[model samples]
Target: MRLETEMNMLQAKIQAGIVKDETVGNTSRFSDANPNLPHFQDDLDIWLTRSERFAESKNWSRDKWSSSLSALLTGRALDCYGRLSSEQAQDYDKVKQALMKRYD
Candidate 1:
């Protein structure tokens, strides 16, 4: 019984750690402003690459990635969201790929 209680306590600690990470990760890290419009594509691309590297399971859910990306975009960069097709908007991977294709 003591062993089981210890295991449960360990599991709670591990779960709590994951939640803390997810909370921190949800914040926007990319910047939307760059004087050179073309160069901004490189910035966005690099951000995406880094995001993938840090993503849980090395794979970010479509909604999670898209939400993060949207939070960071500004100006013309933000306008790209309007271009999403109905089908693409519904899928996170499709939204990510479409935005990358258009912006990066």
Candidate 2:
């Protein structure tokens, strides 16, 4: 059948490296929307706003926000995150408050 032949040709192309078969599971929907937290900027307020928006857009839980923000933090912001107690670090509001206090 024509469909079977086309499928075989597609498989052959993939095997030969002529085509890249990127399936849904292997491709990230957010690849193009990669968000980077602003680092060491005077505009901490703006950075926090953008981070919140990014988390919301991704449908990430509030519980996940602190760790995610910590991972993207750099320079003094990273230091601020590091100085938090383990329990405080787990709370996004605590992390945000710490960062604000550090920068303020």
lDDT, each prediction: 0.45, 0.63
In each prediction, how many residue pairs overlap at the backbone (N, C-alpha, C within less than 3 A)? 1, 0
Quote the lDDT for 38 in model 2.
49
Q: TM-scores, in order shown?
A: 0.42, 0.61
RMSD of 2: 16.3
1-104, model 2: which lDDT tens digit per residue?
A: 44543443343233222334366435232331334544436678888998899889878768767755655566677667666666787789998999999889
Q: What's the residue-level lDDT of 69 in candidate 2?
A: 60
Can you list the residue pairs that collide in candidate 2? none
Off by over 4 Å in 1: 1-42, 57-62, 85-87
Clashing pairs in 1: 62-92
Q: Write the per-residue lDDT of candidate 1 for residues 19-102, one digit (tens) a residue.
A: 224665652222321111121244666765655454544354544544444434444544554455434544557756766777
lDDT of predicted model 1: 0.45
Task: Find the 10 residues in a row with the least total lDDT in model 2.
Answer: 25-34
* lDDT score of residue 18 within candidate 1: 21
| Highest lDDT model number | 2
